[model samples]
Target: MSWTERQRALLGAMGLRVWGETAPEHALATSDAGLEDAAAPASPSDPDPAPPRPAAPERRRAPAPQADAASPPPRASPAIDLGAVAAMEWPALREAVAACRACDLCQTRTQTVFGVGHARAHWMVVGEAPGEQEDRQGEPFVGAAGQLLDRMLAALQLSRADDGDAASRVYIANTLKCRPPRNRNPSAEELHACEPFLVRQIELLRPRIILAMGRFAVQALLRSDEPVGKLRGRVHRYQGVPLVVTYHPAYLLRNLPDKARAWEDLCLAAGVAEAAAEAAG
Candidate 1:
């Protein structure tokens, strides 16, 4: 998309390079060199990197080995039955998640957090996965991070509960029903195993808009590993629903300044939802 000077400036502020734009030869060379050296591409746009915070005590899972170019393609893992999952009602879906052993996470989790809020809500909030507290409590967002999420939703006049206006209510779920061991990032295999559950959740709820928070949620919905900062300004589609990406509330807790960016994402999502609702009416 062609961007105005003001839009380009905003992209600069967000630490994103406009695609198909030229960069200084020296800078481009340096960036390419650094990317080669780095294990994972560090976020290009974080102005102030947040200090590392130790995760709460939990079991650690071994890292999966990186695949080699010459290695044979791995056989397909068992696929989740999306049809059955989608056909089940809310109560049955919850039961299935609780009993799920499709991945290793289910073995360690205390219980599945089946999601919370109105099933038919207009706005759906998709998070990364369950954490220690969430696994124990059987809720999607809880504790300090959850409180912040509630406040964030309140800012948009949306709530997890159904008490608010029907249009303002939101259903919250995660990319994975069970927490990854020690809160380490979910592996591609695990994400694939659990994806059907989430996809079915979206199909069942049919939210007017989806707010995808954190890297995993955004990646799961968009199938892109782009950083949230670069992804936030654009309106994306997931199963025909508009999606807006933002830093997870947990990340926002550490990088407080990004809350403003998150608010911008929420506003953008609200505008899309408004337009969609109007068109439907």
Candidate 2:
């Protein structure tokens, strides 16, 4: 593609080449006779004659490596009491998660993202892990991806609010409480350490239908490594609760065409939730 003069100048400033454009050639050739005449004139006029020598090329050393704001997790982590984690109530669990040092993730996270939404909602959403925004705010699902999820849940007449009706409310949590540094995938040890908190939350809420978003959430719940496409069409079970798998909102943002499939997953989950509510009523 061709660029305008201003555009090319800007690209040059940024050290990026404009694609498909030929580089302009520079000519720096000087004749030996011209240099000899010029030097002869200078030498005749000088009292102390000395030959001119070229200056040595400047030496540039590479800059030192600066550290990133979020450092990698330490290799070792402190142990957590599974029994204590399982027995804690919502308030206690939130405090415990906030103070947890159970895994290496705890070392790098800005804060722990425990969960958000109603205490006993019929619909629950479980995602993979805390990301940059979630870690900063200490709330699961709190950015662009969260916005899309809100739109999806809104279409289903459900929300992530503490005051909505039980059937219209949705509780959201992550497989891992603390975010991995640089938003990298959560390690198995990190997931294992955080599992009890999620288990206790699910046990307490006992949602009619659980929406498992992203690969790790699916694998953590269903113990299956299958891709979401292969697992989403039908209902599955998790802790005796109906579970539906679907691509994560973040993934859907990148792959817009798969939104229809996500809608289908939502509908399937909705039907399962409706069925469960009716059975209870």
Per lDDT, the best of the predicted structures is 2
- Candidate 1 regions off by >4 Å? 1-79
lDDT of 1 by residue, 26-126 (tens): 22221222222112233668564322322222323323434787876334324445557768877888887876766778667888888999878999999
Overlapping backbone residue pairs in candidate 2 total: 0
Question: Please, what is the whole-model Cα lDDT of each candidate in the order they appear?
Answer: 0.73, 0.75
The digit string of per-residue lDDT tens for model 2 on 1-281 reads 23467655544543443433432111111122211221232445655443342232233332333467586633433456666666789999999888777677777889889899999899999999999999999899989999989977765567999985888999999999989998898876777667778989999999998999999997678766667887676676776777888999999889877876786677667767766777788
Q: What is the C-alpha RMSD of each candidate to the true structure, in Å?
A: 14.4, 26.9
lDDT of 1: 0.73
Clashing pairs in 1: none
lDDT of 2: 0.75
For model 2, the run of ten residues with the poorest summed lDDT: 25-34
